[model samples]
Target: MLTPTDVLKDKVAVIYGGAGSLGAGVARAYTDAGARVFLAGRTEDTLRKASAEVGAEYDVVDALDEAAVEAHAGAVVERAGRIDISFNLVPRGDLQGIPLTEMSVDDYTRPVVQGLSCQFITARAAARRMVAQGGGVILSLDSGSRHGTPMLGGTGAADGAMDALIRQLAQELGPSGVRALGIWTAGVADTLTPEKLAGAGAPAMDEAALQGVLAHLDSLRMTKRSPRIADIAALATFLASDAASSITGTWINATAGMFPS
Candidate 1:
């Protein structure tokens, strides 16, 4: 039974923040694609629940911890026999609602430091193993800020930094047989819970306001609607597979129609 799924039959994948809504979706997609997925994040309860759904393994980790990330990659390689794909989707603490002029130095630097460090450590850990294995794919989600968003204070800045990191990592690792790419997505309704939204100080867009944003996004898009988590996760899986092996150093849009770059 040769199939596309067989493509990842023996591959090992590590996904950070796998307990989060978007991460869970991606984890399930990867697991279904036949990869041995490792779910990592802050909470054991959430990680365990997500792993069970994905039929994957779970770990508690601070993605920015270079030592811990390296160890996790080593362990995954040892257990699954190889590390094939890595996705670092750790959330940055970017709820600073102040306008750009009013934002503090600490507020702006906070997310950038956390976001870039996570991507750096996790990607470095995976890249070391992957380069040794001859090649692999690395993806860092939360790139919507690359194109720029007015309402997002630090988020846009953080994502812009990550986007740059992805490109540089791709260029450096390409010769080593590793590929790095990013997908930008924003305001996925399903992933935005009331509690999460309130905590993040996200726009208090009422039904009409939300619709307006969607409509505005739709007008800018070639497509009318935003992508679902399944859609983004599916593309992410493909990007990790041989099908997208040549897509290094590029930021793909899974944003439906909002961001055009």
Candidate 2:
């Protein structure tokens, strides 16, 4: 039997937004699982740092640009021979805390547009290559906003779009041996901070308020503990490897039992 580290042996993985906290953790986990990781993001400095930490290759590629994503995918194929796993962790610009009735149309649609467009571009690029290469996994993530959390702005609509797209991709690509799937998580403990939350368009809050928010998130989970980056990394690693060949076409609930499937 293959050990944990050998599950992804000889696989070549491409991670869009690989410099972010979640992406970096997943890249490290993929490397540890014996896959060759290529980190792609818009920031060269962070990409360089993350890639160095995992001993993976790095490149600057805007996940939202179709040409850029296609070119990047082509280059990865040229260098790595094939892409066995393609994961998109791009940040969708989601504004929160404003009631849908009080928000402008633009504000309500930003995440839905940006998130779906980027995911489509990257997933299409990877899917075309994977179809030719026999088989691969195309992965993505979203905040579990589909549960209709109030005041979450466009997050729920955006996540719903992504959920539909992944299911559609699975149905269309499965015959070609390409699997499409996603993970649903929100308010990861380590990634949540005053600055990061504000940057993502959340209402600004002091440290105490942030702590209360974290506690609330923990209370919602069945485990009574919010998930950390490692939890997401482990799940991503398992999903990307051949060990999960039977799992695809849906979002693996990584919300720590925050909601039922």
Candidate 3:
């Protein structure tokens, strides 16, 4: 059995979109757990920064580009020998705040298309190498918006597609000793801000209004507190470890009870 200190000792992990806040958090946690992590994203500057902070290697690879993703995976395999875990944290470009009646077909399908494409590309790249090496894990992060929540635009559709794809991947890859899973959490406290809210198609708000939004989000959870970056990172560390060998196929609810299992 692995200890808490080195649960991922000697493991090699590749994180897509590793420059983002959540990806960087997970990379730091993985490094702390003794994994050799590689950060992949489109931005070299941010990837370099995140990689330096976590003592990881950085690759400028666009997750949505199939050729780039394949090349990146091959490079990682060449350097690290094998990939033990692959995590996708790519943004889906979702435009929320508009009702279904007002949304254009493009607005409703952009996230679903982008989300599935990037995830499928990255996951497939990792899986091919993993299958040859015996076994590994593929992970993703989503909002779990399949509950038909209103005003979310394409988020629900994107979530449903990713969820179904993960389950199907698990079933097909299980015999090859691979595991595919995801985490469902939204309105993360650390990633929330008025600017981000506005960027996601929500109305601009002042500090007071943003706080009210945060409080409303917190109230929706059974814990009455939003999940932080650290919380999600810790969970990712465990899911990537052998300690979670029995877990696969479905998503783990990390929303702090915002939705029932």
Top model number, lDDT: 3
| Regions of model 2 farther than 4 Å from truth | none
Candidate 2 overall lDDT versus native: 0.91
Residue 231 displacement in candidate 3 (angstroms): 0.6
Q: Assess candidate 3 and give its lDDT.
A: 0.92
Residues 107-194, candidate 2: write the lDDT tens digits: 8899999999999999999999999998999999988778688888999999999999999999999999999999988767988888
RMSD per model, one decimal: 2.4, 1.2, 1.1
Per-residue lDDT, model 1, residue 14, is 90
- TM-score for every candidate vs. truth? 0.91, 0.97, 0.97
Q: Where in model 3 is the C-alpha error above 4 Å?
A: none
Greater-TM-score candidate between 1 and 2:
2
Give lDDT tens digits, candidate 1, residues 1-261.
637666577778899988998898988888888888999898999998888887889999988777888888898888888889999878887764568887778877788898898889999999999899999999988747666566567888888899899999999999999999998876565675545665666567666666665565556657777677888888888898887777899888776757667
**How many clashes would you count in candidate 2?**
0
Model 3: per-residue Cα lDDT over 123-221, one tens digit each:
999999999999999999898887778899999889999999899999999999999999999767888888878888989899999999999999999
